[model samples]
Target: MTFSRGAVEEIAAALAASGLILRGGFSFGDDQVAPAGPSGAPAKSVLLVGQAGAAPWPHFQRWLGQQARDIANPLDTWSREVIGAVAQGRGARAVSPSDRPYLPFQQWAMRAEGLKPSPLGILMHPTYGLWHAYRGALLFEDEIPLPDAHVAIHLCDICVEKPCLKSCPVDAYSGQGFAHEACLGHVRGPRGEPCRSGGCLDRNACPFGTDYRYPPEVQAFHMAAFARL
Candidate 1:
C-alpha cells in the first residue's frame, strides 16, 4: 500500500479529470504524528485537494441539489461522497475542514501553498484571487512523497486601492478588523437583499483574479451558507 510519487500524480490527475485540482500536499513520517482518522488511527501523510474559482461549482451544485432532495445534510454528504471516493479509490483516508476537533486546514494550506490572508480574511490566492477554496483533503495511512512547496506572491500587499475595504455597504471588513455582528445584522436586514442574493461585495471587489469570480448562483449559494440558512 506504499504510494510512490508517480502514484500521487496519477491520483491527482484522476481527481483533476473530475475538475478537482490537487492544490497542494505535504508528507510526514511516523515520527511526526498526524491527526487521528475517523476510526482514531493516526494518519501518516496528507494530500490537499482544492478548487480554484468556480471550476467544480456547476457539477457540485447540481449534485448537492439532488442530495438535498433526499438527505438532511446534503453539503456534508456531497463532500464526503465526492472527496471520499477519491481517497477510497487511492487507498487513503478522507477528512474535511468541518470534521470535529477540526484539523488545522489553514496552517496546512499555508505550508502547502504559502497563501496569505486578504483584508476580508479569505486566503488571497495568487491566481484565483478571492475566488478559490479548499474543498477537502485526503489523509493517508502510509507516507507519501510531497511535491515541491511554492512561494506565492502576496498580492494584497502590493495593491494600494484595497477595494475590498470599501465595497461592503456596512463596512464589515477593513485593515482594522471585521465587524462580524454588523455584517450579520446587515445581511439580515431590509437592505441586505443584494448581499443575500449575491455574494460579499467586498470579496467580489478583490481585483486580483476578476475573471475567476463565481457565477451568480454560486455566489448566492455561498452567501446563504454564510447567513447560516
Candidate 2:
C-alpha cells in the first residue's frame, strides 16, 4: 500500500522513539542515489538513521527483521531494504544490493551524475567527523515524507589544526585525501599499536562527532566490523 509522507513521518517518529536519530547527509550511504525501478527514476524516498549517544545496533537489526515480517520474507541489508521498499512502492522489480547491476552501476551513475567523490574520501560532516559511520541507507518504493536536508560536505572546514589529518601516526590521511591501504595496514598489521588499543587514530581524532561517540561496547562492536574486513 502506498503510504503518505505524513505516515512516513510517523513511522520515522516511531523509529526515533526507539533511539535512532535520522540524520541528513550530503548523500545517503555516501551520496549514491539508490536507483529504483527498471526505469531508474531515482528512489521515491530514502530513510537514513543515526544512532543516538550509543549505536542502537540491535534496534536497527530488529527494525529490518520486523519489516520483513510485514513485507518480504527478508529485507536484510540496506540494499535489500531499499529494493523491497521501492518494489512495494512501485509494484515492480526493485533495486537489489546484490543485484550485480548496482555495484558497477553506482560508479557509472556517479560519473553520469557528476557526483564527485569527497576530497576526504569519507563524509566530513560539520559535526560528525571520522568518528561517525553510515551503517545503512534504505530506499522506499513510496516516498516517505521528509524535510529537505543539506548533506554535510566538510565537517572540518573551519577547524585549523584538523586533528584528523595530524593524529594519524602512519599518515594515513593525506591533506588532499585518504590513503586506504595505509589506513588498513596500520589498523590490521601485527605491528599496529595505537589502533589496537582504541580505534583509528585519525578517526578518533575528529572533533565533529565527539558528542555522538558510540558507547564503548557499541564502538567495539562496530570496530570489529572494520577489523574483520
Candidate 3:
C-alpha cells in the first residue's frame, strides 16, 4: 500500500510542532530484517525522525520541566513519548536509537540519507554537519512513498587541516579510533571544565554546517550525559 503525499505532510506537520523533522526514509529490502509490525508481519518502510541542531531544545526543556527531577534517560523518554504517540496515531511502530538490541540506526541513516561518517564517527551531512541527531523512527506495514535519496558527498576527503582530530585535549580521536576511557576520564575531570561548559572541542572544530551548530547549553547537556555513561 502506498501512502499519499498528504499523509506524509500531515506527519511532518505533527513532528514540526515538537521541533522534530522527518529526516527521510526507505523501504526494507528482502535481505533486511524489517521490524515486526502490529500483526507480527515485517514492516515495509521506515520514516526517520530527528532534530536539526538545537531546534528541539525548547520543546524538550518545556517537557523536562514537568517531569520528575530524578527521571532516568529523560531525553530518550521524551523522544519515545512524542514519537510513540505519532506512531500510534498513524498505526505504526516506534523505534529508538537507544533501544536494546539496537536497530542499526547508523547504517539505516546512511542508507536513507546517503551520508558518510566523518572521522568523529558521526554522519556528516552536507547541511547539518555534526549537530543533528536521530531520535526515533516510525515503521509502517506498507511501503511509503519517499522523497529522492540524498547525493553523498564526503566533505572530509577534501578537508586539508582536519581540525576535529587535533582539537581534543586527550587525543581521544587520534585517527586510531576513539579512546573511550580517556575521553570519559577527561570529560569528568576538573580540566574538562571547558568541554563541560561548552562541548567537545573536536566536534566544535568542524568547519562544516556552522549555522546548524548546537548552542552551548545543548552541547553541555549532551556532554554531561556522556560523562555519566
Candidate 4:
C-alpha cells in the first residue's frame, strides 16, 4: 500500500513519455475512509487519472471520419497505456461517471473518497466543462499514493447565473440531473437553437480550459453516440 515518491514519479514519467498527459490531482494521505463518489468504493488504496487527447484537431478530425471507429485514438492510447502500466499486475475496469446503479458519483467521491466535486458540477470542471470525460478509472487492490490533491474547488450554490443549466438549448441538465435523451436528440437531430445553430451549446458555452478544446470530429462522433441513444 506504500511506495517511495520517486517510484510514483517514475510511473508518471513513463506514462508521460508514452503519450498520456498527467493531470495533477495526486493524493497520498491515508484517510482510512474510502472514496464513495464516482464508483463509490473505499476499498481502493490508490487513484490514478489521465486523459486522452490528440495534438492537432485536424488529425483527430480525419481519424473520426476514417478507419478509426472510436476516434480519439491518441487519448485512448494514453489511457490504455497508463492504465495498463498501473494495472500491470492487477485487474481493472473502465467506468463512465454517468447514470449508475449505486450512489451518485458526486456524493460518493466527495463523501467517501475525500474527493471534492468541482463547483460547476459533481464530476465536471468549470474549465473542462462537459466536453471532456473521464476516459476510465483504474482501481487498485490497495490504495496508491498520489503526488498531490489540489482538486481546489468552487461551490455553485452562490452563483447567480447557473449558466450550465440555462446554457443547454434543450435544457438537458438541471439542478436535479442530466436528461441524456433530451441532450442527445438535440445534438444529433437538431431540435433546439444551440444544437441546431452549432452543436452542443451547453458544453461549448463554458469559458474554462479553452486550450483543451475537443476537436470537431470528436464532437461529431459524440453526437453520433447521442443519436443512437
Rank order by lDDT, top first?
A: 3, 1, 2, 4
- Locate the minimum summed-lDDT window of 10 residues in model 3: 32-41
Query: Given candidate 2, what's the lDDT at residue 219?
Result: 52
Off by over 4 Å in 2: 1-5, 24-34, 37-42, 58-120, 141-145, 151-154
Model 4 TM-score on a 0 to 1 scale:
0.61
Mind sharing the TM-score for model 2?
0.61
Off by over 4 Å in 1: 29-33, 37-40, 68-73
For candidate 3, give the lDDT: 0.91
The Cα error of candidate 3 at residue 200, in Å, is 0.3
**Candidate 1 worst ten-residue window by lDDT:** 67-76
Count backbone overlaps in model 2: 8
Every model's Cα RMSD, please?
2.1, 7.2, 1.1, 6.0
| Highest TM-score against the true fold, candidate | 3
Candidate 3 deviant stretches above 4 angstroms: none
**What TM-score against the true fold does each predicted structure earn?**
0.90, 0.61, 0.97, 0.61
lDDT of each: 0.80, 0.50, 0.91, 0.48
Instruction: For model 2, state the Cα shift of residue 115 in Å.
Output: 13
Q: Tens-digit lDDT track for model 1 on 64-112? A: 6665465655556666677888877576888888888888888889888
Q: Candidate 4: give its CA RMSD in angstroms.
A: 6.0
